[model samples]
Target: MRGLLILAVAVIPAVAQNPVVHLTNATHPASREFQVGDRFEILITGAANQSISVRTTMRGRTDWGPIIGWTNTSGRWSTSGQFEKGDFGDWSEVWTVGGKVANPALHFSVGAPCLKGGQGFAASTGVNLVISCETADGRQTFGTASDSEPFRTPDGRVVRGRVRSNMTADQYHAEILQYLITSRASDVRSGRHGDEAGDLIMKMIGPNALNEDETRNVLSIIRAAFERPEPIPQTARDPSRTLLLLRNLADSADRESVKQQIVETVAYVLAR
Candidate 1:
């Protein structure tokens, strides 16, 4: 089995209103785990009339400190941030907003553990973050209502958790696709069968002569997935299925079609 990081998530209120503030991976939803060092984006939408205030605090389950995103005054804005998990555990990102916010979106990155100072995050699995929103004044004065929602940090918990029967079909699909694209060569050579699948899948995807920037920007995302720790549980899904897909992908008769499918599927999996 491949190693995975686990993080703790903050509990969300059951009867909270609909969230006006939202957070997402720069390329995918929060259900997916991002490699350490990878960057994620933040977006804020909605209509804020008066002076608004927003504060987001994130803490990992382990003792590694917290990743915080905040705004003292609010308006309309779009920005990006990244997280660094010193040690592995469940990490959570909490967002609190006061004032008028129409529909704010947040985009950010997840750094890779192998990155500089990533040893802390790599020591274990990962951390978790939860997102929530509310009126700073606890009233409708901000032009928005109090709303809260829980989001699983893109850490491997979702992927591995699927085996224990917690993930949806879409979540599982995203996990598998992420594994295929990001598993690295070192991990493959580390006597791991899953990494072997990733190695084979990358070859099957085969950049196919893409230009410099195009290849780097496009393939980089896929490759980054391979570099992160495996989030899949041994019992969650059949490894054979993944290997079979990779092998079938190499078959010339259906190569182009499979390639297109992979591209489309990956794109959909990472879309905002």
Candidate 2:
């Protein structure tokens, strides 16, 4: 039966020496209470690597069906593996991401083969386990793991909860967004003697001080950022506050274009 796909996992923490994440299941197929159509939810924590794997075994040949369904952000992640009802019916799949540098995510999963199996022709609905991990250099990531316990598709419905689900979509969005912005600026961390250099970059298009070339570079960066599918009309009145604070670091011969670009870009973004 397709309901045979129920799986639960838990990762235990390591003791002494190097840090490690333990993974196992408390209630597995061995549980007498387990049912074919029974769905559960599980969660894992602190997973790294921008990529995580998941799988399940099929019961038999005639009992299996084709593993099918498409991911929403599929093509962007450089992911691997495939969905198939294997020879014995072990349907497995994996998702690789665009590294933590991209602020990758998993919004929702619909029409998975497993859902149709156990529940007959009906679809199994729930919030798929979403995890984010870090790069080798420690870049922030998202969607790298899943529930450490058994969470049926129904048990793991979307639209998060409080307490265990206190963190809402808005909060998660802010977290991922900040992680991305920080990653982009990490290379320039040392350039800032104080906060002045940062400020100057923020007001890149501003008049007085920054030469034409400097403004142009800053404008290019700003324009490029706007080109992305970013949320229009950002709430950040002055994202360059950090840039302004770093303005003092501007070099003696720094081109003026950069400064003008900074101001102009800020105006353009705020205007939208």
Candidate 3:
């Protein structure tokens, strides 16, 4: 009864593995910082053949707490758009690629979204540029990279950069005051005093004069004024108005020295 028995064996084929893709390099500003009107490039590299999507975000506190760049407390600006494609806010851009490619380079320029306005006076340690990439189908992530660099407005750059380790407190104060005066003069000559008060607030709160706590408090006042839904009044924007405010604060014995410096700075600017 050893009948003829047949044995059948089933074989399964091995599934192909997906190629490893990742960001090899990403280029940015040489200084790792951004200023309005500045142009820079970001280059990302990886293996080719797969479609990928790239997204960039500005990572940091989103509150109106003192930052070096713009703020939207007044709602005059839109913060919910793509920055690469020209929108505002911390979330920057989302770009896609469909064809085979080994490298992708992105170009950008700092604009109004990086300017406009701000609240509070906390010195921005800086913001981070967070980048992420993923499969077009969103199934697999390529990887992520971040640049913990600060984004500064033109004014911010000027004020912060002017601080020299070799400078005495008085020297620092005088130089910054002179800068404010020159800036105000330029505005006066150009007949555009736009945001002069705002500019003053920025310079006065520089690292030279106030302690961190004082700077933050003063900035809070400035922030409250701008948080109004209505546009800031021109009178409020007046440099003289800011001077008056500074003078009033100078009357406080504790803030006398710093406030006097700011008052002198504003006076010099107005005199110019």
Using TM-score as the measure, the top candidate is 1
Candidate 1: segments with Cα more than 4 A from true spot: 1-19, 27-31, 50-75, 85-89, 99-272
lDDT of 2 by residue, 16-46 (tens): 1211212222234343232122232322222
lDDT of 3 by residue, 1-105 (tens): 011112111232212122111221112334543332233332222222323333233332111112212112221111111122121223333232222111222
Error of 1 at 245 (Å): 58
lDDT comparison, 1 vs 2, better candidate: 1
State each candidate's clash count.
62, 68, 1
Q: What TM-score, computed on C-alpha atoms, does each candidate reach? A: 0.24, 0.19, 0.20
TM-score of 3: 0.20
The lDDT leader among the candidates is 1
lDDT, model 2, position 36: 21
Candidate numbers sorted by lDDT from highest down? 1, 3, 2
- Order of the predicted models by TM-score, top scorer first: 1, 3, 2
Tens-place lDDT digits, model 1, residues 140-200: 1111111122223322221111132566544444445434333442221222233343444
